[model samples]
Target: MVLKLRSDFFHSVLLDEEKCKGCTHCIRRCPVEAIRVKGGKAKIDEELCIDCGECIRTCPNHAKYAQTDSMDDTLQRFKYSIALPAPAFYPQFQPNISVGKLLDGLLKLGFHEVFEVARGAEILAEEIKKYLSLKNIPKPVISSACPAVVRLIEEKFPSLTGTLLPLDTPLGIAARIARMRAMEKGYRSEDIGVFFVTPCPAKVTEVRQSSDDVGRIDGAISISQVYSRIMNMLDELEEQKSLQFSSWKGIGWARSGGEQESLNEGEYVAVDGIHDVMSVFEKIEMGELSGILYCEAQACVGGCIGGVLAVQNPFLSKVNVQQLVKRYPEYHLLDDREGKELVREGVFRRRRPFQARDVLKLDTDYRKALEKYQVIEHILENLPGLDCGACGSPTCRALAEDVVREKAQEIDCPFLLREKMLELSREIFDLASKVPQTMNEERGKQTIESNQDSGTATGESGS
Candidate 1:
């Protein structure tokens, strides 16, 4: 199959040309071969990247960045816009800044209305609880909330796709409800735009990659972008009007264990960060993490508040979210009528599994794969396992894979190829070191003359 580049599939961690030193650390570490060194800089191949935030954490130069939508885009789409702020956003502001002050800041930024994504979290918790009550599916349901984790299953672990929790993400569900309420107030659906205040790049990728069943969310604004705008408003804050906010259960989604707590299920384990999530998923795949009802995996460590794209200190956000949650009741009931309708309409739908790419040459032709595999094995056997990445490939295994694809050669290995060249040079020097000897008639003539002269002298002496 032709490897078509899907730019929409992923977003870049903004790579600053000035900061990059051409180190391939990110390129080498990426599970998918998404990073490419081009023109002395690391460039992300959007089609291959999953926006797992690995590159952001790994880049020593801090050059990687994610794109955010301008507020103008949201304002231009509709006469009125609703700011569907993620719970992670709360921590970016001061601890004393009430939710009402936060809402007022959103209004100052031109949002006609403001809604907490936490409320949407409450709805999701209820739905998950109902799902648990019914014993239809397999044990250890993987959380569908994390787009990166979901994509990982789609690409590397397709067999586990069925186990992914089939539900709309908190942001999507929240956006849906916000739009529904806006429409109930006699606002035109087309005129009302809902923008998600996102904490990570993965959420942006999710909105683009997932099917358009969750239609209410028009766009995403990164926390970093909104932080400055909100900060400016905070500077001018004096007397803030009071507004009723959603329950803490809705806002708890910014944290790692928020989802499980929202559902109040004792059988679930909440995990954060990509590496830890991968480890847990591995256990699930191995049938070791069974008997558990749900596995809430967040790719960003410490959950959404700790997302690479977020502006606040993750720890501070965690504390702020906890304080915010403490202010409201632990559990709040969602008017389930709209949520049930959304489920029946198939609007709030789960992403389906896409077919994996035939990366193996064997899938194309076994005979060709066999030939290539032999060549690859020979090259690997001679290679250094150091994975130094001097050959422009990530590791020895990657070089082997590239060799199979005819993209690289065995001589690309510096040490082994250098040694072979040294050996050949020594052999050539030995062959040239041999001296040629000649035996000639002139040598015999000289020896005969000397013997005659010596004999004549001896005869004269005797006389």
Candidate 2:
């Protein structure tokens, strides 16, 4: 299939058509059913995709990948550049590697300066506590830290969009601070490039399509892209830069439950893995989770450490993060007074409200959508309901919707196709059983009458 890439929206998650086998693995695993196998290739619906990197994680053929910036290109683009590494980055290395050593290694990779995203997380954490203290804001304010989860809510759970914490992500906050510091050092704003060493594709998307005017990132580089380079420079570093400024709380954001831990609250629930997060969101929509005051949701299984762009195994990375967290003191870039000042400045808050995506609607017109929905229900009743993905849709209902939308036929379902074939076979057998009218007439009338008389005599004798 010649997949048509969307021009209207930017997505980091993409497909390698040459590597795709059309095995339906990604379509089945995609939480939003954004993928479909068409004409022996996988196609991604850019609008529905959340850039969660689930397709990248599940593709056995390594067909799916995340598009990220090249380090060489990033370095050459600007006079000054800063590296904003996620909290998850620290855990990708051996536990023995000090955070300061990692910062020094980044400097070797052509970055003039390195800023920790964890410091942004620490600042944001303080701001979050203050926000939580406010009354009538909304119950169970969801964390907006995970860009993928935030997009997922926008696409699939739009009603809960209001519940999302209207705050800038750590990467955004870090990029903003890095830019300000660079400007203070005599670098022009346009000459300073802020690039994030991202752990996931979603962050890359966040950097590419950020709506924030203050904290715009120039580009995003995946951790996997620079892992080998960093590894090569680890031993040759001449000096440690004392670059470790973020505390244990900030660094802990790499793992599950770390956000809630920073809040120092017990009423909040931290859910990791995209599917589990969706399950909790469903409960919240049903009003079953009213007692909870906050929700920390991460799209990746072990939080950011489990992102597909990371090099190490997530479980091992989690342990590394836990060990690394213990080594750092509870130091923060911003004191309480400074944090409150920034909060008052609205530096950490989102400029625009989170809006819902209408990608899931069957039609733009309400009456037409209702008609299509009824058609889908009627078609779904006949489907096998196995959700086998053989029809190139994630579920039977999805196939039915596709049929209504003219993207597929009802016979796409193997069970329905088999029934159609059987029905045709029965019709053929019935047609073959009939004698030609000419042949029936050619047989003498006396022969037909004699056969009937013989049947009647046999019946009378048996009685």
Candidate 3:
């Protein structure tokens, strides 16, 4: 079983307690149930977190943030660093900026060279086309681009493991190509670094991992983190049109339906947004979604443009990406020859395919875990079942599970606490009504003697 230790999880996404108001927005918004409210604070379970960046997007307090490499720090790591900007980064301006402008911006930032990850997307798309054309590719072969979506399948929807297409992501392909290009220029491999201008925490986590081919990329910079720096240099535009490689076909990859376009087939569905992807995957698991050759599941809504770290409004950014696509020619800079040669050499392939994370394995002993699950179910039956979120859980059943596992107390539920308080009040009132045993006996005797004395006095007066 592939299991992730909590200690080994990347801390790209972190919560600022001082800024967090414990509003429960983040906990409830989390797709994987990785977050919980505790002690008036939001706590993230590292073992369960997929680094989706949804919490960062949803948090009104701006408490959630991602740690990314800065310009100074990133440049210092290599004698020559290459910038690989995502296609989504292209649409920051209204007129829809040229790819040349973006590449030039990276050059000004001290990168010896700039590569459009979009170009990589085009090559990967070509490879995917060849794979799909072979028709040997599995029905509903899912895209391997978005790390968050891939991790989601690994963690939550393990049943759909067969649906994942065994292809390296464009980012991974681009990194290898960039290194190869640098080596051709007589630079040592160790001296050249590839820094991705990323848009989400998933990419950051991907870059940090040594195992992921895409992760092997030297480092990453979040778009929002470096937006100001790039913006400052935007007005001083130096267009290196010759250096530009990706076309509008590559730019089509910036949004949700672009991959479907790349496939050149209408018999596919592209689902964007984490929740939508989850719902669609559930249908796929149930064998409800049929007749689709490919499934493109992107974690961010409106595709990569809707990533959490984006400074531009997602809707506007999305428009910008679309405009860039329509204005430029489709296959102007797609390098089929070199891309295929690299693919043939297994340059863009992984040693082993991704496996499901053993998130459901609560214990090594099956019998013990089964017994514990039974107890949790029984505890769940007694819960209020309102899923109020007041108990720091998304659902009453979740709280029951937590209580059974001893991770939380029953009193954490407001309804349960009120019942307990009422029961304690009744016990206190009953105790107050009764005296101590000896004191009660003495009081009883005095009452009887007083009654007898009163009767005798009445009799004597009558006589």
Best by TM-score: 2
Instruction: State model 3's lDDT.
Output: 0.80
Highest lDDT scorer: 2
In order of appearance, the predictions have TM-scores of: 0.84, 0.92, 0.90
All candidates: CA RMSD in angstroms? Answer: 8.0, 5.1, 5.4
Lowest lDDT 10-mer window, candidate 1? 454-463
State residue 236's C-alpha deviation in candidate 3, in Å.
Answer: 2.2
Better of 2 and 3 by TM-score: 2
**Candidate 1 residue pairs in backbone clash:** 13-64, 13-65, 14-64, 14-65, 118-250, 118-251
Tens digits of per-residue lDDT for model 1, 1-463: 5445463445735677888877888888776666766557887765557788888878998878776688877788898799888888887776678777787788888898877787777777777887777777876888888877877767666667878777777777777667777888998888888888888888877655544433546788888888888787787653344434567777788889988878753788889987788788888889987889988989888998888878888888899888888876645444468556877766456544444444334436788778777877887888988888766677887788777776667677778789889999999998776433234355455545665877553322221
lDDT of 1 at 433: 65
Better of 1 and 2 by TM-score: 2
Clashing residue pairs, candidate 2? none
Q: Candidate 3 residues 125-226, lDDT tens each?
A: 877877777656557788888888988998898877767878777778778788888888998877888898988778887777634332358888977756
